[model samples]
Target: MPYTLIKSSNPEDFVLVHRFLMQAIQRLRAAGIPLWEPEDVSVDALVKAYGTHSLYLVMDNEKTIGGVFVLEEDALFWPEIVTNDSFFFHKLVIGDDFITKGIGHRVLDALVELAKSHGKHWLRCDCHGDRPRLRNFYESFGFYFIDRKTVEGFDAARYEYPCL
Candidate 1:
């Protein structure tokens, strides 16, 4: 389905984003995706995400299918990995029923487009390094896996997508 890319302006938007993430986690469990196991994504954390970063909501006409938070270079939580001044994708996923429904890709592609239009040469994101499926997902879209780095026991993958 076609989706509209929207920037969420406040913590209230995270209430909707959190619901989508909860659904995504459920779907990942049902699908047996191991690294998708996130025990508690508290509203406080979600609210923090909204306050510190740029939240992009993926909507298909009338529904909020998914969302991802992007923080520009120099924002907090950005480890100095690849030094090209790139955008970052944090908390990226879709609702449970929305998974396998092609919504996540739509939002990501939109972010890539946004980056390229702004003359950004790279788009970077990190995730659980144990998730090879997610690695493949990012790779298929041209995001190259740079390395496996750990922060607080969560193995993280540093992915870089070069602009075309």
Candidate 2:
């Protein structure tokens, strides 16, 4: 089945989306891969994202299974050249129960199309440089590795997909 992408700004969907994120965080922590900080997965932070960014929930049938945050500008990480032409996506997490189900590719493809429709030249994202599996996953999805850098004590690997 195809995945559904819902922007998490509606009050009716906020609770369900928040619960999905919480579940994803718990699973990630249990797997010993500490990607998100505790506060990053909190309901308050997610709600804040809804206000400042485009937060999306990936739904399988009628169930929420994953989410991501997208924005046009991210001065905190991307250099000026990239930030000027890219739609940046962050906090992309697929729920543990849905792993290996190919949901990520569908969601990412949709995001790329969204970027293209918005006239963006690139779809960009960042991940912890320490996680090879995560990096490989992005690479497998055709994201070109741009660079790896440490910012504010966090090591990150930047990737970009040309939205052509």
Candidate 3:
């Protein structure tokens, strides 16, 4: 299947993004993953994401199958890392039906190119530290495990990919 990557800005696309995230949230909770709280899935958070970050959505035809945020400044969650030199990514959510289909990997590959085009040296992100599966997934993409720390009440494992 052919997938298109789009920068979500219009109200309809924003609504799709919110719905996609809510579906991911439900799937995560059902799988016993404490990756996000109820507050994180709200439309308010979606609006905040739109205001603060560059939101990209992967679409198969008209449906949004996945999305992620490319944030320039992330001192709130990753205070230790200098934000000036790196591109930060968050909420790489893939719809439940689209899991294990290499869509996330493709999205990430595009993100790496996005970082490179912007002259960023590193691509960084954080995930629930205790989820080995999630950690390994990042490692599989050539992202090195940097460190683990508690951020905003969650134990997060940081990963960085050198975009050289």
Candidate 4:
């Protein structure tokens, strides 16, 4: 299925994004994945992210299915790298009803194309280090594992996909 990414700017969109993120957080927690805390997805946090990140609502036709945050630079997770040739993806959340339906793959493919259009040489992202399924998902999507590191008190597994 073709998905559209809408850059969220208004307060209403932010509320929707926050709810989507919270649902994702709840799902992860239920699966014993301590990926995100409630505060992490709060409306205020999402609003603050607008200043430094681009928040996008993932849509399948007219239906909103998920959200993602794109950043030009991710100093918190990739402090060792100092280049601007990368687009960092964060908070990628697909609705429970949309999981296991190849939506994740489509989303990543879309992100790759978006990065290429922006002249980004790499697409970088991080997941909880303990989540093997997520790591494998990224690897299967052509992202290579970089390393595991502690960022903001969480062990993160970093991966990067060359936008070639």
> Rank by TM-score, descending?
4, 3, 2, 1
Prediction 4 TM-score vs. true = 0.92
Q: What is the TM-score of each candidate against the true structure?
A: 0.82, 0.84, 0.86, 0.92
Query: Model 2, range 19-118, lDDT digits (tens) per residue?
Result: 6667776877889987666676576776675453477778778777777778888777776664467788887777767777577788888888778888
- Among these predictions, the greatest lDDT belongs to 4
Output the lDDT of residue 55, model 4.
82
lDDT of 1 by residue, 1-164 (tens): 55676787666777777787777777678887754344456567765544544878877787777788776763443556456557777888677666664555667788888778777877888888888888888887778889887766778888888876
The reply for model 1, stretches above 4 Å from the true place, is 35-40, 49-53, 74-78, 81-84
lDDT of each: 0.72, 0.78, 0.78, 0.84
Clashing pairs in 2: none
Return the number of clashes found in candidate 3: 0
Candidate 4 lDDT, 47-132, residue by residue in tens: 67545348877888988888888988888898877988999988888877777667799999889988998999999999999888
Alpha-carbon shift of residue 121 in model 4 (angstroms): 0.6
**Predicted model with the maximum TM-score:** 4
